[model samples]
Target: MRRLLGRDHDNRGFGSLQRGTEDAAKGQGDASETKGQSPIRHHGGKEINREQIHQQIGSLSELTITFLLDKPRILTDIQTEYRNVYSLSYLSDREFWTCSFNDNILNLCNLQGEILRSVQTKSKNWPYGIAVTQSGDLVYTDPRDCSINLVSGTQIQTLITLWGWTPLHPCGTSSGDLLVVMESVDNKNTKIVRYSGSTEKQSIQWDEQGKPLYTSLGNTKYLSENRNLDICVTDYAAHAVVVVSAAGKLRFRYTGPPSTLLESFSPLDITSDSLGNILVSDPYNDHIHIIDQDGHFFRYIYNCGLQCPWGLCVDSRDNLFVAENVSGKVKKIQYYK
Candidate 1:
């Protein structure tokens, strides 16, 4: 958000503040000129009062004035500029999948949260977690049914069933396989599973450590294949994102913070951009954390105002869509450049 929305300059409450800074700068300039070349007995303007200097100017200018602060501009008024509904490909160029702990039957809605169509399974299978395959099949985890349903053009078929209802996140992979994060019976432990045509291809977390790694992981729903078909886990518990071989070998980990936060800001869902960056739904922090393909923190993009961000993903056009579970609204974040 450092360029467009990042430039949040409000003239509110900033009156004489501007005049005060300018007056201080002028005083410093005058004192410096009076100090000849030797400047033995002269101390220019009693120093430039570094803290008082950044009263105006943008956040990007902080480093130009001080050596110890690079604070990001805080935010407000968060609403999508435009909204649309896709009857067939509602989530084609979009990512509207979301989850709920209440375990109610979730409906497919437009950006406005209008229920387009919903299928109430035999159980209150909370399909709060969902994803779409590249070939275009809607896969969702039914907490009640404890299964992943593959919804095609008009029919919803069972793809894979899980023993646990809290399958938190289920994502479709580029390789035509499904990556689902399996929550334990207690909803406190989790593991990632790969389903290839209803067959379990791999148990990413279980196989690696003979157990699970996540305490509250959600972003493991989606994944991009590493060079060797390795799998990566966006560890929400450790406050780090990790990568592993499809064979379940530790690859790399990303544990950096974005603009210095007070507490852990983990992701609820993860999706990749054309640039190979990881776009994560950071609900508590109210922003998407963009991680470069190499697993480095890039920058926060949209930070208008968000209410309980539950799910997020990037489309082919590089546009980002977020689903607010609490507000029951879907948002499309258009990228200007």
Candidate 2:
């Protein structure tokens, strides 16, 4: 199969990029709110500012971490004949989901790469982003019709259709809300939209100074909400990991480490672990960058033998699953000791 990220790879251009959403169904876990100034009262009724506590905790110098840089041992590699695998998401600890390029199909597979069920998308449009809601339902975006669809049982239903903006990626948050990366119709404006079902809850487009939070163009911004409730995105166009507070305030942007190994950083998929650590794929360098919740650079997972690692997800146990784009293989790797 051709490398999905090859230089000569077909440029679908702005119109070629896909869209998707995941259900914020009730069940997996509740989303945390770490972006507020509300007072956190203890059992004895002692009032403490939540934001202050997080800042103090984040600044602690004694936070010990064992950086994992050795090659990640591949637990399993699932081979698929699909031309290009664009995304990987965990439906459960035992099973996960993946979507393909130029196709309207989504596969639910077990850890062994055996397809247990295959769900066809609603429209002929290609599915881009995918995520599992707390209730375990699948939600994805169809760029062809500018709609977000939900998969329940064998039925594919269009939950909502967007207008004026194109939704790029959809992620399920811990609070059972859905976060979507959207670009304006003209491709000059980008923002993150939070939704409860079909109702829009919040729109995160600009910083406190009213500057755009993300690059105004491209479809490479993937979304993930950290355990701390901070919104994390691997913005390929911006060449940085843009993180915002739970309340939509711009927190930090990590461009890249000062290393010669990376010539140009094109971060694609991103996910947060149980420890609140952010893991982002650096396929251009064949490695993954791990960072703290506060956007502090932690370490790199190098020599993992990962070739063009694309989609990334962390299972409940923190086991890292990587999709090797060119080889059409999904590798289950253990990165943390």
* Top candidate by lDDT: 2
Could you give candidate 2's per-residue lDDT for residues 1-337 as a string of tens digits?
Answer: 1112212212255223321111111111112122211111001111235456457665421231643535567888778656457688786667888887777779998877788888888776678688776667788876656677788788777776777666678888766778888776656777898887677789998888888888874667888987678999878887899999989988889888765566577788998776677889876567788888777777777665676677888876677888866566888888766
Total backbone clashes of model 2? 9
* TM-score of each predicted structure versus truth: 0.62, 0.82
Clashes of each: 7, 9
- Residues 18-120, candidate 1, lDDT per residue (tens digit)? 2332343344330001110100110001123334444554332333223211333221122322121101112544224333333344455555544555555
Clashing pairs in 1: 98-128, 99-128, 125-144, 230-245, 230-246, 231-245, 231-246
Model 2 segments beyond 4 Å from truth? 1-11, 14-64, 67-69
* lDDT of candidate 2 at residue 280, scale 0 to 100: 92
Best by TM-score: 2
Model 1 segments more than 4 A misplaced: 1-90, 94-103, 111-114, 153-155, 163-166, 186-189, 206-230
